[model samples]
Target: MSQQTTETTPARLPAAARRGGGPPWMGAGMPAEKSMNFLPSAKRLMGRLRPHRLQLIGVITLVVASVSLSVIGPKILGHATDIIFSGVIGKQLPPGTTTEQAVEGARAAGNDSFADIIAKANVLPGVGIDFDRLGRVLLLVMLLFAGASLLSWLAGYILNGVVQRTVRQLRSDVEDKLNRLPLPYFDKQPRGELLSRVTNDIDNISTSLQQTLSQLLTSLLTVVGVVVMMFVISPLLALVALVAVPLSVWVTKQIAKRSQKQFVAQWKHTGALNGQIEEAFTGHELVKVFGRQREIEASFAAKNDELFKASFGAQFVSGIIMPSMMFIGNLSYVAIAVIGGLRVASGAMSLGDVQAFIQYSRQFTQPLTQVASMANLLQSGVASAERVFDLLDAEEQSPDPVKPAPLTDRHGRVEFERVSFRYEHDKPLIEDLSLVAEPGHTVAIVGPTGAGKTTLVNLVMRFYELDSGRITLDGVDLTELRRDTLRSEIGMVLQDTWLFGGTIRENIAYGNPEASEEQILAAAKATFVDRFVRSLPDGYDTVIDEEGSNVSAGERQLITIARAFLSNPSLLILDEATSSVDTRTEVLLQRAMAALRSDRTSFVIAHRLSTIRDAHLILVMESGRIVEQGTHAELLAAEGAYHRLYHAQFSQPAIDVDEATPPPAVPGAPLLRQR
Candidate 1:
C-alpha cells in the first residue's frame, strides 16, 4: 500500500448531472412503465404453492369436514326433536283417546271457537304447546352444535399456522429472485412498482388464499352436502335452489372487471410517488442550494394527489363487490324461499326439506361471493407478480464459459484489435479501432467530452461487451478468460467513490479483506491521508459511510487511492484520479499515484492534461478513433493534435522545449522522428 499526501487545500468536486437519484422507497432507477405477461409471473407464483400442498390439503379437508358436520347436527336434532316429542306426548296422553276427543267434547258443549282451539291442542290434552318434549330435544341439539363449533375452532387454528408460514416462504422466494437478478433488470423497473408486487400483491394473495381457501371449501361443502340432504328429504324443494346461482355470478364478474384497471393504476401512481420521494431524499441539500424547494414540493403534491385518486378509485370500487354480491344473493334467497314454501304447502316437500333447502340456498350464494372476493385478490397478486417476474426473468449477467482457462499472466499487456462497439447497437460510439500498451508503459488518453474515452476503459473492464472485434490482456482474447479471474488481477481508482458503513480501518482493509490493520494504515499513509486520520478523535476507528454527516471529497478520494495501492494490481486504471482535489491535494495524490503506478501498466485519463506529460506513450482519441500516439518529445516535434490541445490549457508549467505544444506541429497531422 502506498500513502497519498493531502495538504489543507480548498477545492470543489465536479457535480454529477445524470443520475435521477431514486424514487422514494424503491431507490434510484426504478422502471417507469410495466411490461411482461401476468400469466407467466402467476405460473411462477404457483411454484410457491407446491411446497405448501400438504398443509393446503389438510386445511381443505378440515374446513370441508367442519362444514359437513354443520349440516349433520341440525338434521339429527330435528329427528331427535320429533322422536322425543312423540314419546313424551304419548306418555302424557291416554293410550287410545287422543287430543281429538277433547275437541269433540268441546263441540258437544256447543262452543264452536273453543272446539277449534281444543282441536289445535294435540301434544297435551287441551293444551296447545308441547313444552317438556321440545325443551329436552332443544337442549340436546344446542349441546351438539356447541361441540361441533369447538372442533371447528381447533381446525381453524391449524389453518392459520399454514397461512402464515406459506406466505413467509413466498415472500422470501420473491426477494431471493430479486437478489439473483442482474443489475440491468433493476435499471428498467420502478422501485415502487416492484415493492408493490413483493408486498401488496403477495399480501393480497396470502390474505385471499387464507380466507377463501378455507371458507370457500367450507361454503362449497355446506352448499353441496346440504342440497343433497334436502333432496333426500324432498327432491322438488332442492331443484328450486339451483336456479339462482347464474345471476349472482354474472353480477360478480361485471364488478371485478371494473376494479381490475383501478388496481393497476394504483400501483403505477404509487411508484411515481416513490420515485419523487427518493429524489427528494438523495438531493435534499441540492433542492435548498438551487432554491428549487417550491418546485420539488409542487411536484410532490401533484404525485400525492394522483396517488390519492388512484388508491381511492381502486379501493372504493372493489369494496362495492361484496355488498353487490350480497344484494343479488339476498334476492336469490328470497325467490328460493317462495318457491320452496309453495312446494312444501303442495305436499311436494316436508318441513325439514323446506328448511334445509333455504339453508343450502344461502350456502350456495355465500361461496359465490367468497370466490368473487378471491378473484380480486388473485388478480392483484397476478399483476404484481407480472412486474416482479419481469425483473426476475429478464436477462442477467451471463456466467463465464465452462472451464475457462485463467490468464497465464497479465504482465500488463492490453490491446484493442479492430474494435467497434455501441451501447445501443446502432449508435456505433466506437468505430473500428486498435491500440496496444506494453508492460511498465504508461498510456495517457486525452479527448473532448464525448470522445469515447470512458467507453474504451469500460470495454477493457468488460462492463459492456464489444459489438465487433476483441480486447486482449497479455495477448489472450478478453472473452477467453474468466471475467472474475481477469478483473481480480486489475485495480481501479474511479472518479466517483463510495464508502460502505464501517470504521476507516475496515474501509481501507476492504481493498483486501484479509489485509491486517498495519497494512491498512500503511496504505492510508501511502495515499497521504494518514495524518488526517490520526487527527480524528477515533483515528482508524472512525466510522464512515454514505450516511456519515462528515468526510469530504479529498478525504474519500485519498482513501480510494490507498485502497487501489493496497490492491497493487499489475494492470491499473486511474480515471481522472486527481480530478476532484485542489492543487495541493492533486500534487500529493500525484506523488502517491507515481509510487503506486511504478513498474505497472497504467492507463491514466486525465482531464487536467498537465498530470500526464510524463506518460511513456500518449494516445489521442477523437470521435472514437485513436489518431495520435508517441512519447511527449516525439509528439511535440511532430507538432500535431496533441501539440495543439496541450497548448490550449489555460495553465501550464514552462514545458521542456521538446515537450508537446502547438506551432511547428499540429495534433493528428503526421508522425515524425527527430534526433
Candidate 2:
C-alpha cells in the first residue's frame, strides 16, 4: 500500500494581530513607550510584601535605633572641640586670672565680641589642654558610631530575607497562572516573550528590591533623625538646611515621571528581542536550508537596536535626578556655613554647637542624594511588576465544578451535539457539527488541510470550550466533569513527538508513573521500541538530549506510541502517529495500536487511506462540515469525496520513476517518496 502525505495549512496571524492591538514591537513604526501607572503598580507590588509585615516592623525599629545613635555622635565630638579651645584661650592668659578678668581684658583691647565669647566659654584662667576630659568624650563618640554601624548591618540582613521570600511567592503565582491560561492564549503569545516575563522580569524585580529596600529605609530614617538633632543644637541653621528639601523633591519627581515610561519600554523590547532570537535558533536548520540567514540577522539587529535605545533612555533620564539634587544641596550648605559662623562669633551660639550643626547639615543632604539615586532602581522594578501583574490579571479558563459528575462505570462513548467554535468573533471554524462514536468502535477522520480534522479532536479533548453547544462522554456533559478527571481516561499520541532530557525509561514512564518495570518493557516491545533500544549501548537507560536529537525520527515516534500503550486509557487518539516511522516500523506500530484499541473507543486522524480500511466508520470532512460518513468500502462504492481522495493518492505519478514500470518495493523504505 502507498503512503499519502498530509500538508498543513499556513499559519494565520494571531487574533490579536488580526485586530489592531498586537504587541508593541509588531507594529510597523518604531515601538512607542507605554505610559506607566506607577502609583497603582507600585502599590500592588508592595502588597506582595504584606505577609512579611512582622519582619518589616522589626527592621524599622532597628533602623531607628541605628539612625538615632549616628545622629548623636556629631554633637558629642563638638563638646571635645570646646574643651580644647577653652584650654588654649586660658593658657594664653596670666596665671591666677579669673574668667571675669579675661573678659575685661578683651574689652579693654576693644574686642567686645571676643569678650562675650570668652565669658560664655567658662575657660579657667591658667588651664592648659585637658587631655583626660577630651579622651572620655572621644571614646564615647567612637562607641556611639560603632554601635550604629552594627545595628544598620543587622537591619539589612533581616530585610534581605523579607524581600527574597516575597519575590519567591510572586514567582510561584506567575507559574500557576501560566498553567491555568487557555490554549488559545498560548497560541497568540510568542514562547520567548512569555519566558522573559517568567525569568527575566521576575529576576529584575528581585534585584531591584534587594538593592534598594533596606537602603531606602535607612536613608529616610537618617533624614528625620538628623533634622531633629540639628534643631536641638541650632534652630537657625536647621531652618537654612531645610530650604533645599522642596527643590530636591521636585527634581526627583519630574525626572522619575519621564523615566518610568522608558523603563517600561526597555523591558518590553527585551521580551520582543528574546522572542526573535528564540524563533531564529529553533528553526535555524530550516533557515539555513532556505538561505535566509541574512534576513534573520537583519531582523535581530533591528530588535537589538530598539532595546539599546530603550535602555539608554531609561538610564539617562533617571540618571539626571542625583546630580540635580546635589547642586541644590550645595547651595544650602554654603548658606548655613556663613550664618552659623556669624552666630558663633557673636556669642549667640557656642563654637562647638556651630561645628555640630554643620555636620548635621551635610548628613541631611546626603540622605536626600541617596534617595534620588534609588529612584532609578525603584522605577525599573515597578515596570517589571506591572508586566507580571498583567499576566496574573489575564482571563483564565472556566473553573471546574465544586462537585463534579463522576464516571463510575467505564464505557467509551463520545457525542458532539450541535457544536460551534471560532478563533475570532467574525470567522467561524466549526459550526453546528454533530457526531457520535459508539462504545468500542473505531472512528477515523480523514480530510484535507484546514478541514477541521484537528479541531474536532481538540473539542473532544476539551482543549477549547464550545461556542454554542455541548460534548459529552458516557452521557455526562464534558463541562460537568473536571478536566483532570476527563483527561485521565484518554491517551493521545501526536505527529510531533516530545521527549524530555532524561533516560528512555523515564520518558516512557511519564505516561503512567505508577507503571511497573515489567509493564514498561512489555509496552516497549509491543510498539517496536525494544528492538531499537537493545541496539544502543545503554539499552533502555540511554539518555536523550534536551532536543531529543540523539534518536532517529522513527525511534522517537515508536517511543511516543509505547508511552500511549503504557497509559491503557479507555479512549485513545492517534493523530498522524505513524507519519515519521519507516515502512517496517509503521506496520509493527499498526499492529500494536490494533491490540491497544480492543474493546475501546478510538479516534484516528490520518491522511493515508490504507490505514483506515478497517475502521467501522469513516468521516470525510471539508470546510468544517462532515460531507460524507460511512464505512471505507461503502464510501468508496459511492464514488464521492472519499473516493476522489483515495484515487488522487494512488493516481499521482512517482517522482523520477518510469511511467510504465512500478517502483521497486524495499523493506523499511518510505512508501511515498518526496519530490
Candidate 3:
C-alpha cells in the first residue's frame, strides 16, 4: 500500500539544520516501514520489565486465581438452578412464585428468621420440596460469585500499581536519555516532536498498561479454563462451541489486516499535525505580518483532513470485531442449545450440565472477541513504545575521559593545530586551520554569514570536536579535559539570547548560581542591565516569561551579558551580542564588553566592521580560510578582503581598492602573512 509522506514547511530548514531538538514528525513523520516491525520493539520493552519480575509474577498469580474463580462460577450457578428445578418438580409448584416467598426462602436458607424450611417450601402433594438443600445450594452459588468478584478486584488493584510503576520508570529513562543525547542528534529532530514523545507517547503507554495489562492475562486464562470446562461437561457441546473460534478468528483477522495500515497512518498523521501546529504557533507573529493566516489555515485543514481519514478508517474497521464475533458466538449458542436439548431429552446429558455448558460456551467466545478488540490498542501502544525506545537507544554524547585533567592554571592561552571540521561530512566548513591566541588577547573573527565564523568558536568551546588535529588550552589537550571543566572556563553569549523564566536578578546570577546579592548587582551594573531594571515596576525582581517576551530585545541581550559577566570566565565568546540593540544601546553594551573582555582571551564573531576595528587581531574569513589576519590598521593597509569588507560597510560608494594607496601596517605589529 502507498503511504502518505508528511510534507516539510518551506520556511523551516531541514531537521539537520535545526539546532533545537524536537520530535521527528516536525521534520518528517515516522516512516511506514519503521512501524511495520513490532517484535524488536516488543522484545526491548520486555527487557525493561525484567527488573520488576517479582511484582509481575505476583500479578500473574493473582490473575490466575481470579480467572479460575470466575470460570468455575457458572457451574456453581447451574447447581443452584438444579436445586430450583428439583423443588419445583417435587411438589408441582405454581408457575408464578411470589417475590415475598423468594425473600422468605432466601431468609430461611442462611438467616435464622425461618426455623423450619418445610413451612416455607410452598409446594403441592406427592413430592415435598427439599427447601433446606435448595436454600444451601443457592447460598453457595452466591458466595462463589462474591468471591470471584473480590479476587478480580484485588488482581486489578495490584496490576494497576505494577503498570504505573513500570511506566514511571520508563518516563525516567527517557528523560535521562535525552540529557545524554548529543547536539547533533537534537539538530535533526523537532523540539515539539521530542516533547510529544516524552509527554504524549509515554502517556499513551501508561494508558495501555492500565487498561490492557490488567485484563490481558485474565482474559487468556478465561478462554483456556472455559474450554477445559466445556470439554469435561460434554465433548459434543464443546465441539459445537469451538466452531465459533475459527469463524471469529477469520473475521477478526480480515478486519484487523485492513485496519493495521490505518492505525499506523493514524499515528503518523497525528505527529505531522502536531508538528504543523507547533510551527504555526511558534511563528505566529511572522504569519500575521505576512498575511499567511489563510495559508496556515489551509495547510492545517489538509493535515486535519488526513488525520480524520486515518483515524476514522482505523476506528471504523477495528470497530467491526465485536459485532461480528458476537454474531458468530450467538450462532454457536443456538447450535449448542439445540444439540443439548435433544441430548437432555434422551437422558444423555443432565439439565444442569447443559445449562452450565451454555454459560461456559458464552465465556469461551467473550475472551476471543476481547483479545481481538485489544489487538488495535496494543498495536498503537507498541508503536509508541518503539518510538520511546528509539530515543533511548540514540547515540549519546562522546564520553568524557576518565580522570580528565582540569584547567589548573586558567591563563586562557588557546591554540588550534591543523584542525578540520564539517557540519555535514562532504561539505567541509573549516579546513586545515591553525591559530594562536596568547593569554588575554581579543581575537575578533569577521566573515560573511556562512563563512564558518560560529563554527570555529564551536570547536574552541568543544561543543563540536575537530574532524582531525587537536585544540589545546593552557598547554593541555581540550579532548583530555572534562566537558564541564572546559565549558566552566569559557562563557558564551550568542546572537540568539536565551533567558529562562525568572527575575532579572536571578537571570543575571544564572551561570554563577551561588552569586551573592551584591555580586549580582555589580554584574548587572557593569552590563548596564541596572539602568533598565531600575526603570521597571519591580526593578531587579521583575519576572520574565519563558521566552523573555516581556523584555525588549536589547534589554534581554543586556541581561545575558550580565549573566556572562557574573560567570567571570577566563575565556569569553560574543557572537553578534550587540546586534539586537540600537546604536545608543550598542555603545553602552560595547563599553561593558570592553571591561568584561579585559585580561581575558575572548573570541568575538562580529559582522559590524566598526565594532571590531580596534580588536587586537582581526581574522577575516572567506569560504573556509582566514584570507586576511592582522591588526585593523594593517588589514586596511593591505587593501585585501578585510580592506574591501571595511570599506563596503563603513565607506560610502564602493571604492576601488586598486586605485587607493594601501595603508602601512602599524609600526609595532606587522600582519602575519598566511602560507
Best by TM-score: 2
Q: Candidate 2: give the clashing pairs.
A: none
The TM-score of candidate 3 is: 0.86
lDDT of 3: 0.77
Give the TM-score ranking, best first.
2, 3, 1
Each model's lDDT: 0.69, 0.85, 0.77
Tens-digit lDDT track of model 3 for 1-675: 000112122222233565232322234333332663666766776676778788888888877887787878788777766666546554553345553554465465774332123233333333445678778877877776788778788878877787788899999888888767765566556565677778878898888667787777888889999999999889989988988888888898898778877877776677667767887787788788878788778778887899899989888898888888888889999999999887765547666788999889888888887888787787677777877877887888888899897678888999989998877676777899999998889999997877878778878877666899999999899999987788888888877778888898878888698889999999988888898888999999999998789999989888888889999989988888899999998988888889888898999989988898778999998767888899999999999988888878888666456667766778887788879
Residues 145-190 of candidate 1: C-alpha lDDT, one tens digit per residue: 6766776776677777876787888778777776556433443444
Candidate 3 lDDT at 139 equals 81
What TM-score does each of the candidates earn?
0.77, 0.92, 0.86
> Which digits, one per residue and each the tens of the lDDT, describe model 2 over residues 328-430?
9999989988998888788888778888888888899999999999999999999998888888988999988999998986788999999988767787778
The TM-score that candidate 1 achieves is 0.77
Candidate that scores best on lDDT: 2
lDDT of 1 at 495: 77
Model 2 bad stretches (over 4 Å): 1-36, 654-675
lDDT of 2: 0.85
